[model samples]
Target: MTAPLLGHMMDVPLLVSSLIAHAARHHGNTEIVSRRIEGDLHRYTYRDCETRAKQLAQALIALGVEPGERVGTLAWNGYRHMEAYFGVTGFGAVCHTINPRLFPEQIAWIVNHADDRYVLFDLTFAPLVDALAPQCPNVRGWIALCDESCLPAMKTPVLAYETLLAAQDGDYAWPLLDERSASNLCYTSGTTGNPKGALYTHRSSVLHAYAASLPDSIGLSARDAILPVVPMFHVNAWGIPHAAPLNGTKLVLPGKDLDGKSLYELMESEGVTCSAGVPTVWLGLLTYMRDAGVKFSTLQRTVIGGSACPPAMLRTYEDTYGVQVIHAWGMTEMSPLGTLAKLNWEQSQRPPDARRALLEKQGRVIFGVDMKIVGDDGRELPWDGVAFGDLHVRGPWVIDRYFRQAGGTPLIDGWFPTGDVATIDADGFLHITDRSKDVIKSGGEWISSIELENIAVSHPAIAEAACIACAHPRWTERPLIVAVKKPGAEVTREALLAYFDGKVVKWWQPDDVVFVDELPHTATGKLQKLKLRDQFRDHVLPTAAAASEQCPMEPLDANIDAHAGGGAHPVKSAATPD
Candidate 1:
């Protein structure tokens, strides 16, 4: 006979509406603050937010919005945008957050691709909507996210957001939805070609929120005032909108002004205890604080993601400000949160430098996510941390397929290739070496451009740096360091090269350094390496001239600087080809 099975639990589906309802019922008095684009502060409670969200939902349904249809939002992080997120998803429709920073063509393409029936935008994007409306034919209506008095005089007819909500009675109940139904849509930043959409289901979003709010993740609680410096259009502000409400944390939304002074002021005024954003955002805040001779009083911790957090920035935040910096990693495909660098008990007891080294890596995976690295031969690599391979992930919240399967199945044997080259240590810390496309292969040996750039940026004179593979006849490809110097700081190539003398393997050093006024970045503030590569595609290296000018040097061993406490040794310069 078969073994007896345990009794099944409750049959209720995991819906997004339940999160708001719980917050309203239990944490109704908690504050949701916003620095509005209209140059004023807006404050409300969970009760008020839920009431307005319900009214907006009623308005949407009354305007002929059908279940499963897409509703687009082109606005900043504010109470109104939060209401739209719950209103659309709670009503069983998809909330599509469109990045306003994207080019007009790309924005139009995304709107048309999603077949967005209605687009609600902020007053700041009035001209953008007016210009793109002719291109997005499928977008049936435009609604400005403002009151009737504040609505802009647009070329096309547009409705006022507050007026629409005021017309609804808000007595409607949320429909019982299939947990697997699509609730949110976000597109990846199209670095290669056209962008691709990642449709998140209600179940996946809810689970992501739960996992993100755990102690090891964002660690949201009633007492913590959370500020999301990241925009709502990007990966649902890295899932903060949902996670904050689910955990009943005070929400402080920095609307459109993300400058250093603006963010610092918001943090102080709101008594922000924890925050989340990219490194560039924090860089500005740090610079502003340093210039103004200020410090964080209530802010205790920050979660930095979007790109690798520079070691210098991490040290500055911890050593100078007494604030803990949590390094996070994720992408649009993984619901934008895969790992957070939180130390365990044993790791927390380690020496300061050792713990700081661990903090440099991306943290361990949360409970709902699974991670592994595979070699070129399709074999799973060990967690020894020395062998790097293509990173792959699978989880309940991870995407099994993209919206409309734009490029067909993105999974490889049930696991999604994260397109990152990484290594995981015995303690489960993930160290990202580089992107598969960004890794430099020289003389059949792999070199990490990210490592070289990180070390370069640590120099006091350097403001920012990016390393790319330039053409080299002998090694096939050699690293070229492109940098932007700090204001009024004069530094030379030889001095910068000396900074990396003992830090990395001799051959892994950059072949040459070039200073530019600025480096290009993506709309999301990531280095645009592709554009850099294309710009320098046909350029020749300076190795030939250096070889003719310098004396021949001894060849260094393959395992240069391999042992601990090994002294720095001179190796053949880049001029001497392998």
Candidate 2:
């Protein structure tokens, strides 16, 4: 065997600290704006942020935080939280971002699982922290992400963030560490059982940022002011924190105010040109804008992910508001950026309908990621855009294993099997059909719950919709639409079912429409289908008798309570679309 030739390039490690240092040196004057928890906008520069981050590292070191120790945070997206992103990771400790929206017990379980040495929180989460203090025995202490005067009352003694930083001089230099060292720890939104952690290394994080900032991905640049409506705790805000600094782009962190009016005000006031978040947040913003009769001034584009974006929502943003909607798809395991739906020149020049159809897909993979669809027999499927199968992906940024090796190896033959069932066109565009667990199998045919839900919400009268599997005597399980009506809108179940006649195949139409006051959602803004399935497991359809002539079933089950000719509670007037 011949020995490999060595390159003459320098071998500098790619640490998180280097990103902040580079930003401070080159883009020192760029602004990092944040709507703080104190109901006021806070502004700073990259240079200031870098200095405080260094001071924070010094403070953590003074508190005996050792290398590779886990540091937890339960706060909104703001300046202090941003500092912790670089400080803890830069100083060789792991930054574990805890989602505050999770149940207190779940949060405690996650904190204990990570064995967090210190938990920092905003004043808004003071009560939550107090509630979780006794449960999380592994947490050493709690630090409030506020000044001394603004500290909130809590059962346990809390350290003041500003006070801790004030004691340390901002002269500490960032330490160089191995690029493969773990830098960030983010847990999946444990919908099934206990949450599993995805530990990210400095190398993976840096590579993900570079790929995500490319022209075909998030497309970040210095001229754009990017607001990550996606929370910092969610896959590191889909890696925007690192990408923004790397690209010298102005960063705007929306604190806790994710409402439409607040987001509009922030974007207009900050001159934000690009933003990113889940479909639910954008739906709220679009609804608010339509009602207020306003338009966007500086916002040009947005990246919607975390769920399957509805076609109508994408149309509204582009046709009505002039904002380009870039549909994205990924999971917590893939550094959450597998594919972005950016059109090539050839696809972009197609007719409006054709272009929109292509945009509706999840788009193509970026450079580093490789994806393919496989069948149940473990054979790879053809990329014919029609034959859908289990989607599998593997890349540099993808996780080799979970934090604690939870379910043994999560990869099959070197590829991580994403829980999604999808199709890949010849051009490499990935179109997600449904989640493996959420896809409905009726009479041996696969029906996409996501497609059904999208069609249900496309109706003007429907606000939010969820399609879940209901037990059927004839077909093992059938699709049932559980929807919430828009405020002041009147639509009957018959009319709503009729609206889907031409949109989808006749057999794919839901067996029944059940109006609910609201639908449940997971902490990360995903539809909680598991809960819905449990709630209506035995719901009987009106066509049960006709579908199965031999067996006759009652129209309503014992658990079902009638409300305005539909199952479950009566529809509430004020319910809004997700």
Candidate 3:
């Protein structure tokens, strides 16, 4: 015991500014490309980015931005936005990224909630800023993220972004911020109630960036060029902005235009080696490529999240385009990086189909995250892969409390309940069955709407699908599927019902199917199942009618004709929904 333990290692604080500083000093030549809203490519190097970021920080200070105050950015991903990210945080002010996709009221509410004094917005959002300025009374001024020539006319007093930057000298000193000081603020999508802020600290952000750049994670490096199609406002673009700079990877930002054609051209021209986006964005790109008969030359991989990645989409990318799709799962509360679907040596050696099946599950947790499943009685379940329960997570980056919320605990013991029902296999793979709020309960048994929707959308004729609970007389509630067919693809309700044959239990099947032109989606591209549930609240299932009258209108199989295309491939079975 006397052999004194080497008194704890150096105590350098993990600050957000250090990431950019490291990039400038070591990887100064790395390029960052942005597609401007004016439909042109703007390019710069890390050194230039650092210089501009310092200028922006100086300008913000000159504008009376105080340390620890929140500076908001209501813009798309671009060079100016990146500069704001480092500038605000580097100068010890919290950078709050407001989602422009939210409704105008929500945007104003978020700004007011964060107490943001100033907002830096893109030219494309000038109209939006004009509309919100009246509602957001606390906002002192607005800075358009464009030069004087490009600045749009606004009703409020606006300052040109370049003019402000040009007024300041690049020489500036960054404050030595505490490691635990708040760095950024992002509000949840607020599907249920008013939006709540998730305040991120410098320590948590830097640590998350390091974990995200790990080989098993997003795997950023100097040799790679990453295009993050996920918006900057969404969980800090899933932490790609920080990870890219920390590892000195080339960054490509797509501004104001996420159309498939625009994205394809940008990726091909930039020589992007990898990209990340939600499944809907990829579906658009895939559809574009299929129609154009074009393939990527430099893109080697993509990370799909935000929603489940359809098995068909994964197969199409790998089998047709020679691109590897890495499945990832996260939430705004978890610093947006939880688990990445990278296979280990043992798993990589498995058969192709087996490996694909494994990838279908949301992979194991990366370092810095701890996960467990708990049953109804609050007992921790074993990782035997057979038991499903409420998913709970705790880690350096997971949120302990939402900002400004009073008088309630959001944690159980030390773990945050994720509100997702999932099972962890012996090998540590996480299979998410459904969100707790969206699961259907029939005859006191749980049915996963997510599972049913995944199966339904896999059919070639079906373009999108959503399942919601409908009232039933006997079962209390039953699943009703709302589906959108591909243009010109005629898929009948009976044929769709027959497609589920043998794939799921007979009673577990949807009681009825309804075809709709489109299903509603949240601002972030997730299916708004709550809206669908509301739309179908008064729907009466045939089962309810049969139970009431002792006779059904018609058998479910009546008029069912074998469709031209086969049904979806069987997914690996999981624990029966409770």
- Give the TM-scores of the predictions, in the order they appear: 0.78, 0.79, 0.78
What lDDT score belongs to each candidate, Candidate 1 first? 0.80, 0.80, 0.80
Query: In candidate 2, what are the lDDT values of residues 152-206, reduced to their tens digit?
Result: 7679899999999999889988888999999999887553456778888999999
Local error of candidate 1 at 69, Å?
0.5
Decoy 2 TM-score against native: 0.79
lDDT tens readout by residue for model 1, 442-502: 4323455777888999999999998887644234356889999999998999899888886
Q: What is the lDDT of candidate 2?
A: 0.80
Worst 10 residues of 3 by lDDT: 569-578
Tens digit per residue, CA lDDT, model 3, 261-346: 99999999999999987655776787678778899999999987765565666777888899999888777778778887889999
Off by over 4 Å in 1: 1-8, 438-578
The local lDDT score (0 to 100) that residue 161 gets in candidate 3 is 91
Q: What is the lDDT of residue 371 in candidate 2?
A: 95
Q: Which regions of candidate 2 deviate over 4 angstroms?
A: 439-578
